[model samples]
Structures are given as structure tokens and as C-alpha cells.
Target chain A: MKSFGSIRRNFAPWKDPAAKPYIEFRNVTKIFGDFTAVDNLSLNIYEREFFALLGASGCGKSTLLRMLAGFEEPTSGAILLDGQDLRGIPPYRRPVNMMFQSYALFPHMTVEANIAFGLKQDGMPKPDIEARVKEMLKLVRLEQFAKRKPHQLSGGQRQRVALARSVAKRPKVLLLDEPLGALDKKLREATQFELMDLQQDLGLTFVVVTHDQEEAMTMADRIAIMDKGQVMQVATPAEVYEAPSSRFVADFVGNVNMLEGEVASRDENRVVITGASGAQITVEHSGDVQPGTHVAFAIRPEKIKVSSKQPVGTGANAMQGEVWDLAYLGDMTVYHIKLDDGQVVKASSLNSARIHDDPLTWSDRAWISFTPDAGVVLTR
Target chain B: MQGKLSRFNIVSLVFGFAFLYLPIVLLVIYSFNASRLVTVWGGFSTRWYVSLFSNQQLIDAAWVTFRIAVISATVATVLGTMAALALTRYTRFRGRFLFSGMVFAPLVMPEVITGLSLLLLFVAIGLDRGMFTVTLAHVTFSMCFVAVVVQSRLLSFDRSLEEAAMDLGATPTRTFFHVTLPVIMPAIVSGWMLAFTLSLDDLVIASFTSGPGATTLPMRIYSQVRLGVTPEINAVCTLLIAFVTVGVLTAAIVNKRRDLQRQRDEHAALRG
Candidate 1:
């Protein structure tokens, strides 16, 4: 196994405490008057990782990104980049670039000139800046429009130019604030992959801050879910989705159906839950709890099995129900089944074809059950 | 139907122009009148224009005014552009609001009060009042308006472009020069033009601040008009009006080009 020290050496960007991590936020906090915009937070971003800080509005995700870019200094805590502390370093000094939500392309500059700005600032020879700017423009598929001003380009073209400009200097890190948030749904989707491709192509540490859960799930290798200036959970999308650390994580990440109940039985392999709503359900349980204690169980909508008529099975984990509602998505159909005790639980069934050989529509009495592994016990 | 309405719009526009520009026409017409009485026209003659060209004193004063206006306008533009960048780019900065109020104060101030206060300031500083003092005062006054003009341009500018430049490995100073300055160049030009006009037409502030032997063209004209209207003075006024017209036209052309560029950028922004 590679030690942490060896890993740092392997990734040269993390070599010094100056480069221990590509970027580090150590106990950082920012306050605006009486309101604390960012509370005590420490984060480490490794080299070449497409990390995302996902949260709802006013969640301080953008604030954290700004601190890294040196636009807004943290009131307390230290920001270190390439292992060096970013105390007195201004935005220009840091080897970091940012793509604003507005793109902020200079209107007066042609596509080539806008992309060449940072190179010029580096005092690179004129010929070299031109060559690099042209190369970057071609990377973003903007070579043909080099002579056109920002106003002359389309939004997507302008975005590419902005991208070209930032990447031209090859900063160590790229900070994107809702990169595709302004585009229409289709365009946004297309741009998302293009952005990912670009990030991978450059192999730069990219920190994307966004509120859209799907976008975070699709792009980031690691996701940090923030709420009220604190990170609730940080994990890969699969882990965060499969076993959320808390109820907030479960609800925020995806569609989850929850059941409140008490633990009637417990064992190493599985546990039986006697729901407060008068339904007995068994789930694969791995948590800290006592048998007499009250608890909640969570199941993904697509996890449960649905069948017409009562099953020829007798157990504490099965329930008789009637279909209350149905929702038809293009790929699957969701059935909202009301249990005998009046708890409406949702279950999704795939629709592979236009015709349904077995349809569970409204008012159809049915039996619903799931393998213990399908649902997990959530204590918080 | 759209064409006919557009034609009607054109006719009304002509009438509007006639009403607005007829006074200028009268000013030029009377400058050529043979009679001394401005309201009465005796005959068409070149006497006023001939006398105006022959006046050495008026020419010297005009040259002095031009020098002061050009230098002050250029100085004011540099300072104003810096102020505009500071104001628009940084949010929640210390002393920002105070700085903004100070920049805007001179615009609404009456010329008389400004003149008096400046004159007192000069006296307090133990500085002699003359072309130097007048140029200093004009730059001080012109800078505020220039800041305001440039600041508006900065407000409408896309700040992201500068960030992009920084990301590309340019220093903040480089990003500003390469990205920010080029973006707001039109506003800088327009601000310079505005300052130049204000300095060229100034009378009240220059009157209080100026010392002996450094009289500006406006000050000289004021003294000449006081002695009763002369064809020479009339000719000078007419020539000044022509210069102002040309300056305004040039400023408008530059402004229109900037406006078109801004609109194109906005449309592009909406799409990509």
C-alpha cells in the first residue's frame, strides 16, 4: 500500500506542505458583520481531482471557492496552494483560474485577444502568447472565430473563449462557479461533458461549486454536500447515495421513501422492524441501536418488489397493499402503493417496452415486499 | 405601412431638429451682421470674421485655454479611469461608499460655489492663481465627472473576462491592462471628451481662481462683450460654436460604436 507521503511524492503538486495537497483550506472562516458566511471549515483538494462542493442557495459553496481564488480572504484559517500558504497572495499571484457564472468575457477583445490576456500578463514573448492562444482556441474549437469580438460570438462560443482564456495560462487549479447553470437544459447537458473532457484533458484540479445535485453526481469524483456553511458528508456519489450518513444526505441526494418504526428484532445479518404505522418490515441493518428503540428505515423507490394479489408467503416483512397512484417516466413507472394501515409507499418498475404484460395500476390490490438488502436502517 | 409611418417619423424628426438647431443658426447669422446691435441685421459682411482673425490677444488667450483644457482633460481621464476600476471591481471594500460620494459631489455642485471654494483652497495653500491654478481646478472638477462616466462603463463590463485572464497566469496588473482597459476604452475616450468640453467652456471657476496675465478665452470674451457687442467677438463665438459642434459629433460617433459593440456582446452572452 502506498503511504500518504509516497502519494504526495507521486503527485508532485502535493509535494510540500506547500504542495501537500494541491490546495488546502485549514479551519477557514469568513464573516460579514454579525452573519457568518463561512464557519470553521477545513478541506483538502488533491491534484487532478474533479471535486464538487454541492449545496443549496446561501450554502457558502461560492464563498469557499472565492477564498481559494484569493478574491475573498478568509477572516480566519489559512488557504495553502501548491503547499505554500496563500496569506498575502492576491488573485493574480495564485496559480488558480476561475470561470465566473457570467463568463465575464471582455467585450472589446477579439476571441484570440481575450484568450491571450493572461499570457501577455505573464510577460511571455509576443510570438509565444500568440501561439498558445491559438492552440487553446483550437482546443475549445474556437480557432475559426479568433478574429470575432465577444459580442460577435454566441453564448456557447463566448463560454469556450472564456474557457480558452483561463486554460491558456495552465493554472494549477480551475474554479468553476455554476459553469453550465446559465445554459438551457440541453445546452447545459452538452456543455457539462465538454467541461469534463476539458478538465481531464488538462489534468488540472477543478473545484466546481453547484446546487444542482445531478450535475455534481455526473461530474465530480468526490462530492461534499454543504448546508449552512458546513459539510454534512463527503464521499463518492455511489457511497453517498447508497448509505447516506444522515437523513439530510438521504433526502438531498435522490428520491427516497422513508418508514418510521421501532426495532422489534435484531441480529448480525438482518433486523426486523415493527413500524409505528402497524406494518412489520425487515431490512438489512448495520447501525448503532437497541431492539426497543424507535428508528426509521429508508428504501430507494426502485428497490421494492410489487406483485398483483397477496403472495403465498407468511412473514413479518410482507405487507398487503392497494395501488394508490402511478407515475410514468420514459424509462420506468413508479407505483405509489397504500398499505392496509394507510402508509403510501412508492416503488418503481422498469418499462422496457411500450406494452406492460403486468401493470400495477390504480386500485389494484397487491403484495409488496423486498429482500432485506434492498432497504437499510437509518437511525438519525 | 411600416415605411409610411417611418416617413412620418422622419418628417417630425426634421421639425424637431429645426426647432433645436435654429438658435445656433441665428447665432451664426448674427455673427456676420454689419450692425453692432445683435438683434438687428444691417447687411452681410466679412468685417467681423476679418477683425476676429486679426486679434493677436484673442488668439493668444485661445491658445492658453486650449493648452490648459487639453492637459487637464488628459490628466483627469487617467485618474478617473483608475477610480472607476476601483469602484466597480471591488465589492464591500473599505471606504468605498465614502469614495463614491466624493467622486459624485462635483457634478451637482454649482459653479459659483465650486469656484469660491477652490479660490479659498488656493489662498489657503499659498498658491498663486493663474493658468496653472486654473488648469489644476479644471482637472479637479473634470475628474469627478470622468470617474462617473468611466464607472458606468465598468459597471456594464463583464468582470469574468479579467478573471479568465488571471487564470491564464497573468498578474492582476496585467489582467487589468490587457482585459479591463481595452474593454472600457470607449468610456475613457468619452470621459476625456467630456472633461475637455467642461474645461473649454468654464468661466465661473476660472474667473475666481485665475490670476492676472493668464486670462482664458472665455474670460477675454466676457470682458469684450461687456464693452458692447463687436463683430470680432461675434466671429470668435461663431468659431467656438463650430469647434464644439465638431467635438460633439466626434464624441457621438465614438459612443455609437461602443453602444453597438455592447449590444453585440450582450446578444452573444445570451446565447453562449
Candidate 2:
């Protein structure tokens, strides 16, 4: 989260009422035979924004991206690009480009030719095409490898070529399907920043589809989490992580300990929850939830603390538990505590000191505690 | 332990190769015989080769066979590529199972049955049998082979390549020409060569489908063999073998050179 530079541009056009959407899907639904790949969905993407469609496979994220790319038409709605309807316009006529997951560089052509293909198809002048191709190669730092074929390059190099080729025409929008799904972990992390920088430099809207939550969180300004052909939630990474709207969104984005509970009492400032295991919980957020309504309390593992002795904070809610398991991860130690009510909760503490002083061990009597504002109440 | 050739393996290899090639070797040797007798070789002379040029009937049959092979192979390649595309690209079309069955039926159906059925079909349609009929028959059978070869290639083709082309502002037709076709060219080339060789060497199907004045090289050679084994026939067979060998060798050499050039380019890229 450290600032890499002082120039942080405000890319949140979604918050601006007067700002028009660069791409919009209005009540789009795509069906294949009898299966609905994308249900009735409406979404808006702003210009020059890094948007991510994040979901598991078969969750309709890829189908939504393909609809925007004009590869698949919605059986029931319209897609607009820059205020123009994108119906009956084939993919070739659409002002969008896609970098395929496989990095489908033409095997029969050299890197230069593959980058020049779209320009040649547009009947650009020969000199202009050459200049553009060279410029793209330079942008990807692959100027020396222009004459080589795709197979001759490494995986990261091939990916760069695909990026360069897809952006050579400077389309209004760029679609990337699992852009880094094929790379190794370390390389994928590095390429994520590179792709973000490239998108910024080109000032082109990028709609990336990925199943990896970390990838979406790192690269996208906003992510639309999808499930079962419908959008589950759309928000900034921090917003989704902090205030997930549903139990599904909370569990899918990160690790969470869920406690089925019923609302004991509700007020403007706080709500008391009675866990099924008889553990009383409290949340700070006030909602219209009625007393005695069934709900689930979702708390992230890192927000809870497990101590060998009873904690001394009066505002904190504490429960008696025994450590069931402990894992010492170099930077943090995770302890799985089983409460006396037969409920298990995970708590992690940062290992800031070099030496462990009176560390909690296996089967040790411990106190697990969190404040009223550390968890979210999920009604659905 | 895995790759060492045992004595038994060596013996079997030698025996298998000799069994397969001894007859062709003998034929080739006798094609250069000076004497008229087929078995008794007077000396190594080019007499049979010299007489082969003067045989007008053999020359005419050779010309007919060449024309039929060229026409049929060309037609078969086009039709087979279409069939492969249909089978691979259109996965959910109606009657897909029946279409695939029909495409593959000619491959395993007895050649005699196929030839007889085709002959009857032509007669029922009142089409005069000639070089055109022979070519039609060749096309019918060889197209299936081409389809099988090209279909396997298409099965392995990365479909995303086509999508990439379209995403880059190329229409479907242009994508096929610039991306799919060039990538599948090797398979198509081999399929066409196979069709040509099959048409060139066919005897039973051609005899059943051909009419008067459309005698192919196989038909002419069969008739002469029935009469007697002449050194002139051996000479013609030797020349046919030479032509096929040269063609196959040239193709292999060209393909190898392309591979080598690509490898060298890769090395240069890595080094620089």
C-alpha cells in the first residue's frame, strides 16, 4: 500500500454523476442452447479504468467479457461502446481488442508480422505499419526479438508480444482473458504491475477476467465478483474486503470465520447477536435488522486475537477457548482455538519480535477476543 | 537395457526388409536387362528403357493416369478441407453424427463394393464413363483419406488463434486465409500427395469406373502382366517408383530445411 509515486490520479469515474460510461451492458443475458451462461446483468465501465471480472470458472465472468469483445451476443439485451450500440457489428468492426489467455501469436509469422497483422488488415500504409510495429516492440521491450517466431520466445516474452499486438491499433478498450493465468507465481506478480503500468500509459480501458482474487485485487481499480451467471458484488478491493454485502462475497474474497447467530437486540449504535453455540457477539454497524432475525456474523481471522491469558480491554468481547492447532508462519503465527461451546475460530498474530516470549502452545488455555467493530453481520 | 538391439531383433529386421523389398529390387534389376527373356539377363543395358519410349499405348495410358491423378487430387483436397472444417467447426449442427459417419464410411468400406456402387451410380445417372468418371471415382474415395488427415490436424488446432485474429480486426474469411490456412498447410499438402499417389496406383476402382479410351497406367500394366512378364513393364514400374521417390524426397528435404532455418533463427535470437 506504500505510495510508489506522488502522482495518484483519481480514476473513480463511477462516483461522478455526470461522467458517462465508456462501455455499458444493459440487461444482458446470453444463453447457449438451454444453459444460461450470463443472466440478466447490467454493468457500466468507465473510460481508462482498470476493471476486473472476478469469479470461478463457469460463473459467467468470461462470457460477460466475451460479450463486451463482441464474440458472443447477448440473447436479450444491448451492449454500448462510447454511447453507440454494439449490435450486429462483428468482432472485426468493434473498437475493442483482446489478449487471449493462450497468447495466440500467429505461429507462421514472426513477432513483427503478428504485431503488424491488425494494421495490415486495416489497409494502413506500409511505412506507417512498420513504424507502428517497431514502436509496439519497443514498448514491450522486445525490439531485438521482432524477427523471431512465438515459439522461440519465453513465456513472459510471448505474453509481452500478445500485449503489444493487441494494443498496436490503440483500440478504445482492451479485454484480457486470464492475462497472467499461464505464468508462474513470481513472474505473474511482476507482470501484474507491468500490465497496470501499460494500461495507464496507453490510457485505454482494460477489462480483465480472472479467477484469482489476489490478481483482481492487485490490478483492478474496481472488481465485479460474479457467481451463477449473476453479479454478486461490485466494489473497490478495500470496500469488498472490509464491508462485503453478502456472506458469499465475504467468504469468497478471503478467509472468514462464520458464526450462525440470531439477533438478540438491535439499536442505533450496536447490535447483540446470540450465536448458535451460545457465544454472545456484538457488532458496531447499525442496520434495519429486526430483533430475533436469523443472521451470520462474519469475522476475518486476522482481526481476532488469541492470548494465553484473559485480555484486559473492557470494550472487547472475550471467550474462553483452548488452542487446537498452531502454525508458525515466519511473519505471522496462526492459532486455531476451540471455544468451550464447541465452536472453532482461527486467530492470527504478527510475529514482530525476533524471539518468542511465552508463546501460546498446543492445547493451551487461551482467550479469543475482538472488538464490536471488527466483524460484519450478514443477513443473506 | 531398453534400446540395445539383440541378435534376434537384427535378424528379424533384416528378414522383414528383404521380404518386403526383394521383389521390387529384382524387378528394377531386370528392367535394365538387354535380353528379351524375362529371367535370363544378358547384361546391364538400357534396352527396355529405350523400348518404353516407343510404346504408344503405354504412353497414352500414362498420360491419362497423370491427368486423372492431378484433377482428382486437386478436387479431393478442396472437398476434404471443407468436410474437415464442417466436422470440426460446427459441433452442434443437425445430423452431425450422420455426416461424420458418411465421411468415414468410404475409408473402411471394401474397395470393390465402393467401386461397384460408384459404377452403378454413374450408369444410373447416364453419365458417360471416361477420364472424368475415373477422376470422379478417385475423388470419392481419396477425399475420405484427406478428411481424416486434415481432421486430426484441425482437432489439435488452437481455436483461440482464430478468435485472436477476429479480435484484431480481421473477418472470418480473412482469418482463415491468413491464420488457419497457413497453419494447416502442411497437413493439406500431405493429404493432397496421398490422394495423388492413391489415384496413380489404383487399378480395381479405375478399371470399374473407366470406359473405353481411358486406360490408366495400372490397367495397362495389369493387362500386360496377364499376358507375360516383359522387361518393358519392369522398366515402367521402375520409372514410376523413381518418380514417387523423387517427389517424396523433395518434400522431406524442403520441410527439413524449413525446420532447420527456424532452429537457426531461434539460436540467433537467443544469442543476440
Most accurate candidate by lDDT: 2
TM-score: which candidate is best?
A: 2
Clashes of 1: 15
What does each candidate score in C-alpha RMSD? 5.0, 2.7
What is the TM-score of candidate 1?
0.87
Chain B TM-scores per candidate, in order, are: 0.86, 0.97
What stretches of model 1 exceed 4 Å from their correct place? A1-23, A80-83, A125-127, A312-317, B1-22, B35-37, B82-100, B123-126, B157-159, B257-272
Measured with C-alpha atoms, the lDDT of residue A129 in candidate 1 is 84
Q: Alpha carbon lDDT of residue A123, candidate 2?
A: 95
Each prediction's TM-score versus the true structure = 0.87, 0.95
DockQ for candidate 1, C-alpha atoms: 0.45
Which segments of model 2 are wrong by more than 4 Å?
A1-9, B124-126, B256-272
